[model samples]
Target chain A: MNASLFDILTIWLQRPNFIAFIILFLWGLYIMIAHHNLIKKLIGMYLVQTSVIFFFITVSAKAGATVPILLNGESVDPALYANPLPHVLMLTAIVVGVATLGVSLALVVAIYRQYGSLDEEVILKQLGE
Target chain B: MRHHLPVFVFLLPFGMAICMPLISLVRPKWCRGLTMLALAAMTGLSVMLYSHVIAQGPIRYALSGWMPPLGIEWIVDGLSGLLLPLLGSLALMGVWYAGPLVTEGKGSIHFHLLTLLLVSGLSGMVMAGDLFNIFVFLEVSALSSYALVGSAGGRALVSAFRYLILGTLGASLYLLGVGYFYAVTGTLNMTDLADRLPDLLASKAVMAGFIFMLIGLGIKMALVPLHGWLPDAYVDAPDSVSPLLAPLVTKVALYAVVRVMYWVVGGEEVGETLPILTLSSWLGAVAALVGAFLALSQQELKRMFAYAGISHVGIIVMGVCLGNPTGFAGGIFYLLTDAVMQAALFYIAGTAFYSLGIRTLADLGRLRGQMPWVIGVLIVIAISMIGIPPSGGFFGKWYIILGALEAGNYIVVGGVVGATLLTLGYFVTIFERIFVDSVSSGPAVLAESPLSMRATMGMLAAASLVLGLMSDPMIRLILDHAFPG
Candidate 1:
């Protein structure tokens, strides 16, 4: 059991795409928390959403898989075709993410127009008054 | 036609919302009339659906004639059956109360459209049988609410922006959690996931998914630490929007939490395999105490009520985490009663602001004499908020206490009692200032609200009493069908 666990850990470490996705997700979260600029915060939000999209795409991929579309007269093995459901779901998610980004950008514009600053601290101070 | 009730319940509002902008261009009066008409129709349909569920069992409707795991399905079970009518009626009352307020606003047409859309989204969230569908509906409601909040402009814009950022982050987290579930179970259908989840309960991915989902929903429901956006959003939103949102948004989120826990995750894992329930119970206890204290410190009426809402949410969460039918029943009862009480209170605040042009407690200076009906209703609602007997709030608290005692959760029982006392402390102070104190020199000019607003407030205030009297039957219905052992 211990040896198998170690093998799984090693294999996971070698998956660079998964590692990159994790790093990007964390970096996006960090920027969302650490940045004061509202626009930059929205960019961070987009990055977080993009990372999830990447994660979904990675999960749907197979080492030897071909496109999911089938030929008219051919019998195809399911194993040779990549899963298409996750891709479709991610497409919906990407649209949702884009819509959310658009709304957030509009809100930022309104905030800037009102308060004359996009900095979190400045907005907070103004709101306090 | 009856078979199509589930879809019609949501589709009516959605269709009307889509047509509202065009309708408003032709006749703005028609827009308001159409919104109320849609709500009334939904209320009637929900009542029909609820009775059908009680007579039979769960009703499942597949979109486009496709079955579950392939096409989206809507389930009107005992839970949704109870909630649907509650949501529909409350929305009707909200619209009735917002009539004058909406007409006063510049974007009256848009406001009506968003309100309809929000109601559609809420109904969809409750009825949806698929996991991803819930997320979609949640975003629909969240996005519309953000726009509604920002429609008030000025400070509301900032508050709504904050809400949008945090709400989007929460929704994204929820989606990530859903992705985990999909990766493991290879299905998005809730019932299908339930069948697959038992064997995978011990898996790290499933556990991570549970935690992520909990945190995400916790933010949406404004559970203490993650509740930073709630007060600002509620207090800064427009008068009409505040009452509508205050009653529904978090309650719907709580409904989703209950649905996922009981239906999808199942109670066994929530009880035995993980300490999540216990942790939530403790978090709730702390939230109750902290929320009550924070509410006591606020001078603004709406802001104080927002904090008090957090406290009541804590109580409901504690009830749910007890992991028994009795506790679950208590949670549902509290949710229903709290919706009426909070809506009534916010309506009063809105009316007060509309009439007297102020919401600060200091400025309220004994105008109860002029607007006696408003003050009277306010007193009754405030008493209910403190969980006084013969009001719906009392029965909810009583059941929660009984459930806590049954579970031997003395700490939670103590927290509930303490929270009640704290509730009384703030509410009593407001009550005295309203009824007992002399009218101060401050602007004492009092203008009565419209008859419609008063009637809506009176009806909801009466509901608190009527529901309290009927709580035994209500609890029995909830336990026998909603949480059958």
Candidate 2:
């Protein structure tokens, strides 16, 4: 039983990409929830987005697989090549991510201009809301 | 033209959204007519497409003539057929009415641009046949709304930021869910997912995908506890934005919910393999009760409508999640009426505020003369809100209650009746204050809203009555194609 548990743990830990994603996502969520600074929260959002993008890329990666480019005069074994669809989709997601980042930063600038601070607690207290 | 209807429905607006700013740069005055013409053209095309889809089966358009599983697909079926027309017209009417009120000078360009983008995004969302495509459109619509929500400046900027954060999180969760689905099946198309999903019901990935999707959509639907961003998003948006979004945004999200839950997940599988559907019904019931009570306690007019929208969302969720055909039929039809009713009420609020600075129940109640036209439309709204006969709202809740009865969910039935009674209570007070009370604090001779605002309000109020008359056919059409073998 002890040997089996260790094996299972090793299997889960083998995927370095998944592990990295979890850490990044959790850290981002923590900042979003725990940080009172608005800019910090924005950073958290970016981290979360990056983690998701990382996850998409990870799902498309394969062991011993070459890029999805078709070589001349070679019979195709689909499994021998990394999947290209998720990569294409992620490029779209990346554009969306950039757009949201731009929009949010614009919003942050607007908030700072009006309230003169980037702290949530301070702004709310100022509003007496 | 008919062959390309599915693509043209959204492409027209998206192309026009791009052009609006350019046109404003040169002939600024022409932007108004272009905006109206674009929306009108989209609405007309949607109606024509709906009829075509009804006669012929689903219309499927592949990008660049590439077939599905390789190229993206856009489909117009019975479900989207019904939605496109309703969403298009409501948007057209909303922007039309907003022109006189909120679209003033330099800012008008951005306003029209964002509104058209919203239209384009919603149209794409309605027609998108792939899960990832839906996500793309979802972000498109969401980004535009985030911009619109803050366009009013001042306090609205804060609400827009909060909405952006919450909305982005929800959408990302949905995208992750799509990744999970794609990882397992290697396909993003809805019909392909449906075919692949049943065999993998026991897979953990499938379970994760479904749960993630439900939670994401729940946030978008603003189902009770997840509704933190909703009230402020609606209440703090520019006056014109509120009228367009307040009535329409959540309903489009509901369209997404229905699409994913039934079209992608399949029917009996949802009940047998999942308890989340049941959870949705209970949460919906609780949200209905809580939201109604909250609306009852509000003094501000728009906030009250915002909270009430949450309540109706709860009812609609309960309706569609019943896992019965009757429930879907009822819940789906009810949302149509609810969307219309919501638009009518917000138009009234907009008209009142722009005309007489009316913001509270008492303020609206104390008005004496001059809104003779408004009084007639107000009666229609009050009738629909109270669930009386010959109004669309009445039939929607009736079917919901009847559906709840069929499902043996006594709690949901009570939620429907209880919220209705509560709404009746407040609406009556407003009426009594208006018609019964002798005191009059409104201006001695108050001026009515512009002709355009009044005309739009009248048009929407009249639709609720017509929708009630039309509910039977609508229900039948939904049943025929929405759940096909």
Candidate 3:
């Protein structure tokens, strides 16, 4: 029950992962916000999106866990495997993200042909102003 | 036998869509035939599901023979069961209208494939039992929508791309929220998640999940501040794609938002803990008012209708936000009526464009004499859209008002009344020009839109009127069996 040094040290160690998550999130936000070029913005968007996927994978990973698939009782145990749902979900999401990137790249290609630049500023200026 | 109707309703269109590409290669023209057949089958299946839900209570279908809390499950409650049929009908109209309208050049193939894919995605969203499944189908719908929106012209391509980015963000937020929920609950089945949410409601992670999902879905639903992508997307999408995209896609997204708030998140229990109900309802009111007034200012035909849709969406959202069963019913009824009525209106509008080259309301003057039937059909559809008596639109608005009054939510009651007036303010202008006084010389010698187009418009118009008369029975069906415990 005492607030011992060992207990405080353990809590502080756990804090690092949370800090890392926050850093990744901010990094993604920066890419999305600071970038003006559409392709660069998309790459930033993907990085931000993947950061969430990374969060899922990290959070779902159990200490000393193996792959999710089951084997003979002697070697594999249910508790040892990392949670598979988030991984499975992230897999589907990656496929969707890739499909979206393809569609977006195609659109950017068209936008470039018409507006002659991938920069959002230039395209809007030419189209509207 | 009747209990299995929801399963078939989803399966028929989906299977047909999957097979559509291969079929398109054989007859080419058969793609239209195939699409029509598939829509017809879907309509038939929806009717069966409607009746089955009414008589026997909500039908629950477990996907892959897995029960909820363990495997995915599809529940066709009154809310969703009703949507299935409405979606099928609008889709049927879209395809019927598309065959004659899609440009003859390179646009034709892309048009048919995207339409079929959109249908599949819409059907899947309505029937999906799990959060992940809903997200999957949502993407399918959104992707096809991007392609369809881009199909009209180069500008449409730009608008489509914008929508594509925004829609992806919405879907990604939803996926992230679902991931958080699954991390906490160890399940994705909606019913199971509902059972599990209360335990995790206090967790900071779950709170973040809720925030992301709410904002994400709000954007997709075009709620107020998040509606940036909609007007352009709706306006710029080709005439053929407008009717479907205008009514069905947005309504389905709204349904998803409502589903997340109500059933999946467990309604009053969860709503009470957060300000979602209050914020959403207030925003809904703002949306309704803003959307209507802005609509009145637009000169282009489709653009004005697009704003009107945003207004009506506010009304529907208001009903959902009231967080009462009656309010929910009213909201859903509005969706059903709005989809059919709006689809009819857009078809007639598109007919005008196809025949007379009138894209703006200003050009509509010359059209008065050229296409009286189109004019007449539009007048009827517009009257219904304005929620006059003896139209399905009337019944839908009536129930929502009844729900609002019962909840003693006088603000919403007033909002509903004000919106109705606003609705009239905009639509009546169009009606007067078309019906009462021709903008040009004496009633012009009007040539009718093509037979198929006329038939499709006529069918939707007839449904609007007939559904009004049948409103009582439908209400009972929706409230009793469709949502029974």
Candidate 4:
């Protein structure tokens, strides 16, 4: 309610949100670039994807907000809650993301059976120069 | 009830795909026949849907009676309507071409089942109005495509795996974009998100959304620099599978871009105000020329077609990036014509490979005098690719040029012209070998193609010619009412 605490809260909100998003983004990128195993790379990609979800959830938050459900037969105040829509969308995204991972893993398994290795470098070598 | 064609566009294939696996219980032959019938039915329904949309304007059907912005919806304007028929016709033709080949491979019932799922997924991707729903079907198409690609065994398995890795990255990026859009606008429905995005135009999350979505769709569309997966996937995929996968899968991905760009992103309205407008258009132009150059250099017949497919995608995107209605319609028309012609061309290529055992263009010289019928089919398809008269390819290129000129974007026009000329160059090489010279028959003489194969090629070649003549109504339908500017 007061200016001093409000200023502190806003600063706190912006910094941590920004920091969390950056860390997740970098971590996901690292796995994608560094992991050589096809399945591990896929897992890394999914982790990178989850990091983005983390970014969405964090940025969508409001300071001092409660959960976004109707409680005690009363409509909750908008200012006191993070939006539920993004969270719901993220859930759907997570489902799709997982499904994609499953498919990719299935392909990887098939690849291993055929090529006898999951290393990206080796597969490319076998394919051609 | 006719206003609800959008729902049927998706549901018909979906319902049929669910039941296709069970057909194995009756008999393998029965399964193939039933699958063919289902795809044919889908084709007929889509043509009807196209006519309906042309007459009545875009048909919007909210899922389960819930309104959009609150629930998922399906939109079938000229764009989706145009795409539905293209998807259906290609699937039907591909199945017809593939049926015998599967028997040749002695593939199991799962082969037909995966193909059905691929069709359902592609149809759903085109018709879906919600961003996340598109992702669901996108995965369906991608997963099934992976299986279809790998079913050839040996080297195809590696190619499919590589495609899977790249494809998963693309999907992840797309999901990342969706997350960003949700963070900014709190909705995944394209129409609602478009309406809401303006309010968050300056938000960092929205910027991230634009980048993520563009990169993701670019990978799926197999644009330049992101197209590493295409050649192998198309080349190593079975002779039966390449035509279906190459023509429709990437085209559908491009359709997704158009949907997000024009309808969902509000085209010029959002582009002029956005950060990525200039960059996206520039990337499209670059892809057009680069893809063409890559295509011109390939010696393998199927790989050449794959590169040509990417080049055409670049041209379509170039037309799109012009940000005008004519440009949009031209892009859509190119999409339709390209899918038809490319599939037909690939089908002929596969036929040659099957009948002659010739995989490289250099080796094709051996079949020069041996296969007149196949050579004639190739000439027709090649003429279309070269944008010669009396072919749909010419009209597609004309509109793209017209759009670039309308926008005063000479660079894009130049790219289109160069790609067209390159198209002529590569296809002409094949033509000269086919007709201008003769080769002595080898120990393994060429065999005449079966009636089924000949009938399919003749039908596709005929459709290419007829589609060229039918452009007047098709152009007006997509350009006039579907997107009123």
Once fitted onto the true fold, the runs of candidate 1 whose alpha carbons sit more than 4 angstroms away are: A1-9, B104-106, B436-439, B442-446
Best by lDDT: 1
Q: For each candidate, report its DockQ versus the true two-chain complex.
A: 0.68, 0.79, 0.48, 0.50
Query: Each model's TM-score, in the order given?
Result: 0.97, 0.96, 0.92, 0.92
Give per-residue CA lDDT, model 1, range B1-485, as digits (tens): 77888999999889999999888888877877888999999999999999999998889999989988898899999989999999889998998999888873348887888999999999999999988888889989998999989988899998998898889888888887888888889898988998899899988898888788888888898989989999999999999999999889998998888888878888658666787777887888888888999999989999999999999899999888877778889989999999998899899889889877768887666556567778889878977889889988898989888988888888779878999999999987787677676866466555678988999999998999999999999999999889934
Q: Would you list the rank order by DockQ, best first?
A: 2, 1, 4, 3
Which residue pairs does candidate 1 place in steric collision?
none
RMSD in Å for all candidates = 1.8, 1.9, 3.2, 3.5
Give Cα-based local distance difference scores for all models: 0.87, 0.85, 0.79, 0.79
- What is the Cα-based TM-score of model 3? 0.92
Residue range A6-105, candidate 1, lDDT tens digits = 8998998889888998899889989888999998888888888888888878878889888766578775777899889889888888888887887788
Q: Please write out the lDDT profile of model 4 over residues B13-105, one tens digit for every residue.
A: 677678766666556567677777777878888889888877777777888999987978888776777777778878878878876677722
* DockQ-derived CAPRI band for the predicted complex in model 3: acceptable
Please write out the lDDT profile of model 2 over residues A1-129, one tens digit for every residue.
467987988988898899998899889888888998988998898888888899999998888888766579775688788888889899999999999999999999999999999999888887675
Candidate 2 lDDT by residue in tens digits, B1-485 = 79798788898889999988789889988877888888899999999999998898889889889999788999898888888988889988988889886656688888889989998998898899899988889999999999999998988988999998888888888888898899898899998989999999788898898888878877887889889999888988878889888777788888898888888888568677777677788988898888888888888888888888898898888888887888888888888888888888888877778887878877775555757667778889889877898988888888888888888988889888988988887677667766876765645675767988988999998899998888888888888865445
What shift in Å separates residue B344 of candidate 2 from its native position after superposition?
1.1
Query: Model 2 misses residue B7 by how many Å?
Result: 0.8
Query: By the lDDT metric, which is better: model 2 or model 4?
Result: 2
lDDT (0-100) at residue B89 of candidate 3?
75
Q: After TM-score superposition, what is the CA distance of residue B165 in candidate 2 from its true location, in Å?
A: 0.2
